[model samples]
Target: MSSGNSRGRGTGRNQGTGRKQEPQKRESILEYQKYENKMIRVKFHGGREVQGVLKGHDNLMNLVLDDTVELMRDPSDLNVITEKKRNLGLVVCRGTQIIVISPVEGMKEIPNPFQQ
Candidate 1:
């Protein structure tokens, strides 16, 4: 008799399919590419926000940032926002935790900061 359990079977979403998943469109890559090595703001779940330099990223949209600064609002006064800066130097942020990424205004661009 065949086992009824579907576990361990490679039938999950975007998995175990014979066909290769199409590569990400160039436009999407280009859009994020422009932000590389630039100072940007990242908002996350639970009202947390961070600003840092875009160091690297992956297909999963995970990010590596340098000079990270975390922002938070005062729990007693929601209207009051506080800034806590830390010299993280480098950090890898999970893609699932990211809410949005926006370019920082009035900051000079660092051309090809990733070049060795």
Candidate 2:
């Protein structure tokens, strides 16, 4: 009865693997300074949309928006927007889960371009 297995004491995991965990070198879209104090709309995944004044943004794409208004979607159709809306004043948006970010200025509903 050996007290402990001689070859099982040390758990060798990723020991000889030359894979060095490196941080992501992805560059930020940046240029958020110009959008500060300007109205912008951010559409997130899962069909969530919000509009607010750009207050501040960091290198990580995290946004500090003021006077944020979350646009409510139709229950029947997720792509449709209802007249109802909710105000989420002063919100911090995550860099991830952001699908689209556009300026509210000069923005209008356009017909589907895929239509023949």
Candidate 3:
């Protein structure tokens, strides 16, 4: 006698909804992908600054700095007047907590040699 009640399923639970699903939230700050392989100045915590041509980034968003140099270098070594060689190594910084990433002034966008 009560077979109708048992056969009814709860298919109308969400039938009243007329709104579309919300779109994904966009990032507030500018994304870093546009400036890949471009030279940039990154300011770290404690007022420390570094400059170099950005090489690449890892999956963790760590920046790779090639041909980098310290902001300040001692001039005493230049007085030696002898042949000396110095090699600069790569610098990597995690993007999760970088204080700032600013482009160097008067820096023109250069073509990426890797791109055909």
Candidate 4:
């Protein structure tokens, strides 16, 4: 009679090859670690821009921003731009629509408003 258990046996796939498999390189849209917990400007498709503190992100580059503000340019006059403040407190932006992510220029690090 044979035991019905198959534990601790060399019966699994890719066993005993003695060759170390190379780690798969993961694709990422941005080096989000550097931008974490910092204020960043996110430019999206259709010429929309958002400025907020980068709260969090995922491998797909989907972002969670705090104290977000939406920036738009006047269609009639390209030079005339307007900003609409959003009270979302925390906003999640889809990665696919993101065009660029950059540090906010000329601004020092901002403290999290939610913490205070």
Q: Can you give the TM-score per candidate against the true fold?
A: 0.60, 0.72, 0.47, 0.62
Indicate which candidate wins on TM-score.
Answer: 2
Model 4 lDDT per residue over 40-103, tens place: 9988887877889998888887899999887768878654456645455689999999998889
Candidate order by decreasing lDDT: 2, 4, 1, 3
What is the C-alpha local distance difference test score of each model? 0.77, 0.87, 0.65, 0.79
Better of 2 and 3 by TM-score: 2
- Where model 2 places Cα greater than 4 Å from the true spot, the runs are 1-27
Query: For model 3, what is the error of residue 108's alpha carbon versus the real structure, in angstroms, after optimal superposition?
Result: 13
Tens-digit lDDT track of model 1 for 24-84: 6644443678888899988887767778999998877799999988766787876455764
Which is superior by TM-score, 1 or 3? 1
Best by lDDT: 2
Candidate 3 lDDT over 23-42, as tens digits, reads 77655365667666777887
RMSD of each: 11.5, 6.8, 13.0, 11.4
Candidate 2 vs. true structure, TM-score: 0.72
